[model samples]
Target: MFFHQDASFEQLSIHRVGNKAQDEFYVLSEQPVPFADDEVLPGLLMQYFMSPFAKVNEVYRFMHPNEDLELNEVYHFTKKFFDGKMDFHSLSEQLAKHLYEVSSHPKIKGGELYVVHLKNVQMEGDSQEAIGIFKSENKETYLKVYPEQGGFQLDYEPEAININKLDKGCIIIKNEEEEGYQVLVVDQTNKSQEAIYWKDEFLKIKIRNDEFNQTGNYLKVVKNFVNEKLEESFEMEKADKIDLLNRSMNYFKEKETFDQEEFEEEVLGNPQAISLFKDYKSNFEDDFDAKFEASFDIADKAVKKMESAYKTVLKLDKNFHIYIHGKREYLEKGYDEEKGRNYYKLYFENES
Candidate 1:
């Protein structure tokens, strides 16, 4: 199938390889994609299809929660989608109609959702056409989103609010020539902002995708390396390990790059410890078949994204995440007589 939009809806915009245009998106198939997990697959109302873009490059787009669906749910959603009663476009309209009903935010005058089930889309590169789908909510006007609390809410010349930056959107790219697709999702509503009730409107489901649940594999491995290997190898205590991890982060922040010797000195603060680190780094990488960076450059974006993983935690049986950071003096570990439990007491001053 090709080139479909409601005849009444003239607002459907297409970005493709035209003579005058540099950016382009082409829909190769009018058919719904059969998707998979680990392999890509689509969810209900949200079908899974592959787009050619996934092969050419990996872009960091905020994915929807459901984009990374497991096999069963994927089949369920796709089955509901392709049940043969409603076509892709009809399903899209049904979704759009529901969203319009629930958007009661006085300022957010609602908007239209453009759901085009596409396969094989391409950009300017030499890569072949890819299969995927697009479901984007387009607004007639920008919603007044920002609040007066942050700063002077001054009237300035308006620029087109980036849809992906502010509202809900999703793009799924089919994997290579295969039927599976990778997804990119975006949901930009602020915490304090009044709800648009997209869920109440249609598709009562929370999105779950690998993109949103990214463990930052490399950095995660680094963290595990510290926790599993180095923590035990050096006979370091939990506090020591936490401190070392904190110091390593700072070293990277100040130096902007990680060097083994400096990390040893600043974090371990002893020659013997440094030697142990060196040995472990070498052996661990060799065993894992991964290259240990002599100097690992820390990107600002990565630091921002991965900062929370580095925090020290005292897990208390689902009660709280007692986050501890800073010098050890502020924390006191002791035994509780009545409770028959060991406890970590944190001392702090309320400067405010």
Candidate 2:
């Protein structure tokens, strides 16, 4: 996990970036932002920038398709700043200009951009310096209530930033310079055409192929094969599907490493089903540009994060919702001729 418990701001600069499509421009700050020697304001700003990254597990590295990393603007400027070849204020201006250039989408909003240099950030039990780039596009109105002359007075601030909701942010860690510096990003506001500019057009980052991603991607492929591809080739009941899902989850939970042959033999007893699943997995890898290892260490964090999506519920018409956890043989599906409907017979040894 990423943590900033002991992190402190070394320097911070804020600039305004406008949408280029609307013929707007950007304004750069002349110098770094100054704060008091105390920790109150710095602590608040730290929470604003770093709180959203606490549970972030996916890591990305800046990349250029042409194999020249200098072509990536963010990577270039960030490397210069980290190497002390460029100043903090100048780096912030350059980053703001780059962001404004990519803000060509008509629907994108203009906002204040904050660039901060942080020190002593704890990332996976390692201390590293990081550059935090955050943009606040949305403002909230907050009302202030205070006692004045034994009476409460109310005042409202129209343009206030909510610390809890960060619009767009990324932290460039200084650990991996040769591999694009281990960047973590957050874009909570825009998700449409405008969102592409933040991570794709501007940052130019690609996912790092690590154990976490491998585990997550493989689990997603398995889920898609069960939900989409299995029905095309075989006639399987809902209980059978749920059982497959349960067995998949249990294998990942119980085993440290994954083996394709073992998984096929244990979870998928049918040889034809295993062959079909292998073909579907190959297509999935080709379409998504992902490679899955036949044997790799399973990440527990990925499994826990993806557990919610692996549904085990069996819905019957409009009345009953049976949650099938395991033991598919215990549940039987049959057609009731008298009622002209389908029914399930559940077998159990004890009742709760």
Per-residue accuracy of model 1 over 218-324 as CA lDDT, tens digit each? 35545666787775546766766676677666655566565666666667777865665567667755664345555556555555566788868767667767655
Local distance difference test values of all predictions, in order:
0.44, 0.90
- For 1-352, candidate 2 gives per-residue lDDT tens digits of 6889999899999999999999999998889888857669898898899999988999889998797889999999999998999998999999999999999999999999999999999887899999999999999999999999989999999989999999999999998899888899999976687787898898999877788988988888888889888988899888888889999999999999989899989988789889998998899778755678889999999999889999999987788899988988888889999999888999999998
Query: Native-vs-model 2 lDDT?
Result: 0.90
| TM-score to native of every candidate shown | 0.38, 0.95
User: Model 2 residue 213 lDDT?
Assistant: 86
**Candidate 2, superposed: residue stretches over 4 Å from native:** 36-38, 269-272
Q: What is the lDDT of residue 106 in candidate 2?
A: 96
lDDT of 2 at 235: 93
